[model samples]
Target: MAFKEFNCPSCGALLKLEYRFTETVICPFCQQSSHWTGENFEAKGEKVILADYGSKFSVGLQASFWGTKLGERKEYKFKVLGRVRFEYNDGFWDEWLLRVEGYEQNEYWLQEDEGEFFLFKKFDNLPSVNEYSELEVGMYVDWEDYKMFISEKAKAQISGGEGELPFRVIPGEQCDFVDGILLKEAIPVSIEYLPDNKKAFYVTIFNLDINDFVFTEKKQENVY
Candidate 1:
């Protein structure tokens, strides 16, 4: 990916956008968030979720994982692109947009709630989500070897978003998503199904340190 020289319209601070799959960016210096309007960057609003619902890993954080089923790469470094907060009736969760190194053609979303994690990769050829959108709990769905159980399902709205995102994800966009879990193994895995046309996705669990990816010394705000 290439870096594009630009300044945050909200703050006077100089910012650079990696011309990867992104449409919005937040200034690390001022916490000013803006949306990319294709031609120009327009100020959206100031990011507010930095304090409440803090994250272990901050946006702009860099990390690498080996043998990713999402990208089908053996090993690749990924940059934390953006963090979007979703609020349902029960509670809220955080979803992170990640950009693969050297590859801007695709983007991935890593959803995290508490210690539970789910990495979603969209596949067009996969079965339509509508076919099993109403899967009841206690029922199992086969995915290769593991039989994943429908854990929970609900609708959420994008409460807040900061940093660079894959597309225009402004506040107030409602999202319909579903979740599943596989308890067959000692370490249970999870799944998140989206109602998007070609947006069916699955997860691969991971646990990593925030210190390794975030520049905490320079940033005081929390972005999960």
Candidate 2:
């Protein structure tokens, strides 16, 4: 985690990109969204600022967690690097990017929905389906020795974002999503089919409780 700094195209504010593969940067001063075009940054209009609901997680916060995943106990000390907010019919959820200490390339996604939290690792080997339309709810999918039952499906939009993200975030960009669960282990899996055939899958590694987290950073007023 090294970072590169850039000048905001809209307000001339400085933007530091913490994520190596960041494709978009939102100016903290002006809330202007800019897309990196390889050559330079281009304006994508002002993005909506996400409201803080006091969910106990925010960018730049340091925290630790002790949990067991897949029958192995582990402790993680990490920092909240960024967050992407998605809005669906049920409301919204925040996907926080965490940089885990003591590990190389150890970034993980922590999803917060309602009061439930799940830790996930990105799966590089995507499912065979090229399009979301090809899949339906209640279908059983067998992949990598696990039988997963499709539990939920929805179309969601990128409502807002904070800090740095690996990919471009276009506000109101919609994508089709599918959620599955390993029945025996109760492991949750998520799939997203985005525009331009880009897809991503996240395999849930841990089910977390609120008490599992210990804030390592001291709280400061107006930080969130």
Candidate 3:
């Protein structure tokens, strides 16, 4: 295990954190949220409580799952970080910030809605705002030679967050997106349009089956 220390640029508070691909943190002194830019931090905004606090899956829960990536067998230990609530139409969905381990990448997102659990990641190589702004719902895009379409094109907001994150997640950070769906698997594919093109994008998405996955609770251990 290794550790890293730095000063909060916002309040000059000594920011000591667990060093293992940490991208964002909230200062214990000023309570200001920041993004770790490799070596430095830029203040994003103040953090706020998410719109919905009670859910089946809360932040800081630990779970293990037999997930497949790149067509290989690997283990995944996920720690829930932040939970952002978005108001869409008369319904809503909670976006859980997950700090992932055992995977090649450091982090990803897990979302649970209705009776389905979704796994998603951000990918920036897609058609940009200007490129896809004119795109309408039900439009198809060639992806992996599989037919993908814009399913729900709407706006959302970062209702709140907890723990560390990699994006400027000031509560109420407006979000707009055009979601893609895979018809065969009824998969809610990845497609998030970051407001400032700052947060990461989504490229890969999967519908995790409970039978093929395992989950466990987090231990009462201090990561620090």
Q: Estimate each model's TM-score.
A: 0.65, 0.89, 0.71
Angstrom error of the Cα, residue 156, model 2: value is 1.0
**Candidate whose TM-score is highest:** 2
Compared with the true structure, all predictions reach lDDT values of 0.62, 0.79, 0.63
Residue-wise lDDT of candidate 1 within 73-134, one digit each (tens)? 45557777778777789888787877767755755677765665555554433553434465
Q: Could you tell which candidate, 2 or 3, scores higher by lDDT?
A: 2
Report the C-alpha lDDT of model 3 over 48-162, residue by residue, as the tens digit. Answer: 4454434546666767666676798666777676565666665667877676675536457777766566778755454442234755798876666567777767777665555
Task: Give me the displacement of residue 28 in model 2, in angstroms.
Answer: 1.6
Q: What is the C-alpha local distance difference test score of candidate 1?
A: 0.62
User: Which lDDT tens digits does candidate 2 get at residues 1-224?
Assistant: 45677898988987777766677777777877788899888878556798887778888788988888567878888887778888899988889988778753755789986677898877653756335776678988776787888888999988878877767788888866899887798889898776567888888877898788887665645435
Maximum-lDDT candidate: 2
Model 3, residue 164: distance off in Å is: 1.4
Error of 1 at 67 (Å): 6.6
Instruction: Kindly report which residue stretches of model 3 are placed more than 4 angstroms away from their true locations once superposed.
Output: 6-23, 27-31, 37-39, 68-75, 127-132, 183-186, 198-205, 209-215, 218-224
Model 1, residue 70: what's the lDDT?
48
Segments in model 1 whose C-alpha atoms lie over 4 Å from true places: 29-32, 45-47, 52-54, 65-76, 102-105, 124-127, 131-148, 182-200, 205-224
Compare candidates 1 and 2 on lDDT and give the better one. 2
